[model samples]
Target: MRSSNLLKRAHSHNKQTLSSLLHSRGTSPHPQPDTISGHKLIEEETNPNYKPEHWYPARIGEVLNHRYELLVKLGYGMTATVWLAKNIHADGQSGNRKYVTIKINVNTLGEDFQKGRRAIAEKLFSANPQHPGYAHVRFMLDTFRATTKYGDHLCIVYDVLREPIDLCMKKFPGSRFSCGKLRVLLPALLKGLDYMHSECHVVHTDLKPDNIMMGLGDPNLLDHFVQHEHDHPSPRKAPDSHGRIIYTSCSDFGESPTEAVIASAKITDIGLAAWGDEKNTKPIQSNVFMAPEVILQAGWSYPADIWNLGVMLWDLVENIGLFDSISTEPDHYRPEQHLGLMIALLGPPPKEFLARCAKAKWYFDADGQFKYPKYVAEDCKFEHSIHRMNAEEKDLFIDMAKKMLTWVPEERWTAKQLLEHPFLTKERECYWDTPSLSRASTASVGSLIPSRQGTPGLGPTSVPNGSIHHSSLPVRLLELVPSLASSDATEPRLQRQSTNGSLKASENDEKSTSSSTLPLKPKMETLAESKGESNDETLHKKRSVSVNKSNESSQAMIDAILNRGKNHAPKAPAK
Candidate 1:
């Protein structure tokens, strides 16, 4: 798959280069696609095939509302384009100019625009200033209609913000933020989520990386984002034709002055957020961040936000997507595969939760295996447990992931509940010492070590003999020493020899196992040899006893261990 993608990209690159050369010499390589004429509605914005008219020919120094001047385009989304503009009336204060972000809705009469306007207006009018999340939420300053050459575009003004958290992730790559930084950012996000759910009675249906923007305090990073007037389909310069900048009215497309601001983290873009009581069967959330309840058409509320938050945190920390929805096959079913991934990483959904799901049969059977195996082929390659952290930290995070991503929406932890979890609270770092019975009765997260046992198992949830099992080795050690159990069927058997000097493998199997066993290397023997100084006598006796035991089978592993004795200087045979 990777090679195929590289080949295709190489072909495209060569083709583009050839085309560029031809175009430079007054020859047409390929005809351009036709552009469509329209009022630039939602269909135009969404359809890749359509080329809608620009809502704003936003140029430098364009003044709006007799005060705000459009300086640069910060970003754009489905229904709106946000621009960084300066306040002409406000004087500079605190070493920063009073800059604002104006979000102009593409079509004022569009349904999305009206709905968003109503939602924001309602929240602002009734919003509690004392709410804890208020500081984290983007502050909406004003709203008005900007009459352009095309039509009146609805515009909402806000204090200028830095880049979104996604940009921050891209900037820092692996370390999205240090643990110290996370301690600050995550708590603020949780506080915001708690306040929105409990006090504002709102559900932020779309809370992906793009929605969570940075606060203004960081370096100015908007120059590259701004679209120059020459780059626009039509530059609304004065009729002088020399293209000198000019401002006609509060309605005209003209240049705006600029200002600088720094960045931090804040929750923005509440266009899709809904009242808590609103009921609908429509889909919400970015595909990769979609909760199981949203996919199953089961009802959802605050907990759904918690699920998104958890996944986002994973992406921020790990620098990789926790749940990838990209389909390998063109015909692959997404929901089935997404659910399969959830099950593979966590565990099976509760039967009662499955009973409530309308499409449960399509995804899971009575025994919890995926019904459509082909659709979820991607999940087949995933390990049952997260293989990234130490046993303790791995246990801690998986427990948190499980709590946020439960099959039952009701069973998932709320933002407030999660904020109190030991993973988030510094004071409760040692809380794992107290065995809190897991929400899932089957097993606690610490027990589920990723193992070679064909099926990854919760390691000795209960020891029958009250003695430690071989599997009880620290997960770190298990990682270093590959488990024999997960190897090919014909591989040599590996079992602990009895302390009474009996060999673990039977004699009949000895011949068949030798060729299958890995070759012994000097470096591999160092681990076994480090335990004792009188190593030669101990090694010689073990080899002799293993060969003498009729019950013993393949001595490949024992031979590998004993071979280390040969690598040592023929130390004077102990008298």
Candidate 2:
């Protein structure tokens, strides 16, 4: 079967299974309740660290900036609550209603942090908007402040997007992306990273699955979502002691996305991003994906993001972290263990590299031997870990991984260089274009624009003007990589030799290929449609909803909650 057909079948099976489950439970697939008893814990209220006062008390129907109207809760995090909102005052010339995502920050953040965030946002906005990778980035669109009795809240806006990539991965079989999907995803991801590193001079310190979100390919989907919410308001918890009503977050975007929608995935959550020039030892990145330099307190720059992405690929493909042994307790991070795993897989770091690390002495002795040598797991070899790919595919993937996972940050491939890897381009051709299966090509155009009532995942058929050709990439960008060229000529100093007395093909390997022919372009519609803040903070895990309650009983519970709220005399809406 063709890959596209397989994807469609998978989506169909998932939808059918969901419908069956909902039917078995005697409830609608999209259930909306007016209210639930405040006694019932939901979402953020269940968070052990949740503080009511720290959060902005945003109501479902409340209007912000006299323009955007909050429709429903989308998600929440440590720092803010995200809402799907409708723009009441869109550009009159277009006469089209626009939907946007609003991230309302908590009031508890310090003034200095707030100012720094604003400064970073400004720097992101100043990046070359014309860059091909610009569309692949979830850039901030607008910002304003909302005032309340508790404190002032910062409101940042962005284009309405679907669920994060991490959630999307669950829909796929084996909880991993198909090679076809990876081909579409990785190139776009790398392009966005390149734009951040080279054109914007920004380093996205956080590059995990949660930070990458699937873009809504059709604007009509947003319209449908808004109409759905208007017709059926989401169920909300009754007024709490402070009159706070928490609504069940509705993050689903109706149906499963087509390959094109998946292809349009964008890198998001620049909240932890920093300027590349401002290299500092301040610890950043999620603990598992933390680069060696970061763990060692060695100053890092854009190359750190390459290592982060390299580790993240395992999560995307293997459905588990590559460095699972880094922490003995699931909640606690062990730097020594992580370094040990790195050494076991990639061999010992060079003495020169360790010399720059402030914390190297804590783990390594005077001669550079790991003090805790027992921590190194001999079986933790990269070749032995990957089980899914064929030999050819595995070879290409390992080569790409090695390029990005080096101990010396400078030895890691730039995002642009990785874009040309055979794992993405050549493997895509072999998988998608096999002669045995005949169908319309499923290859992505590497760019997308919103279309009205289009086929699933299909974007505009023609490239827009000002589309970027690979050949047109500036020479200076290529010239800036003298270290990579020099490093490629010699064997990598850090690679471990296998017991067979031969080094793995992943180490110090290079393949010469024709220049990338992929046509790159900005999403023209995104420039206008995109708006919103990054909800990059850690979010509370979603609790499963029970479907056992009958509609009549549910209505009765809502009515009782309403009567209870009335007796207490809930506070009036804010002005």
The candidate that wins on TM-score is: 2
- Candidate 1 regions exceeding 4 Å error are 1-50, 94-97, 108-117, 173-175, 218-264, 328-333, 364-369, 374-391, 427-575
Report the error of model 1 at residue 471, Å.
Answer: 36
Please report the candidate that would top lDDT against the real structure. Answer: 2
- CA displacement after TM-score superposition, residue 533 of candidate 2 (Å): 48
Predicted structure 1: lDDT: 0.48
Per residue, candidate 1 scores C-alpha lDDT tens digits across 1-575 of 11111001111111112113233332234432222233222221332322334454455577988989886544445455566687878764522346777887664357665776577546744677786666777756888887756677778888765555654544443546544345456656876776676567677877776677655453233332232221221112232232222211111111111111112356776666766645545667767777887887666665677778877766665545776555634345377767767776656676766766666777778775667555444443222334444444444555666666666554444555455333443222322222222222222331222211100010001111222133344443333232212223345445423222233331112111110001111122354567653545443333332121111221332233234334443778788
CA shift of 421, model 2, Å: 1.1
RMSD of 1: 20.6
Write the residue-wise lDDT of candidate 2 on 49-135 in tens digits. Answer: 678887788898899999889987777765777888878888533322387889988787788877876777776667678766787
Error of 1 at 144 (Å): 0.8
Candidate lDDT values, in order: 0.48, 0.63
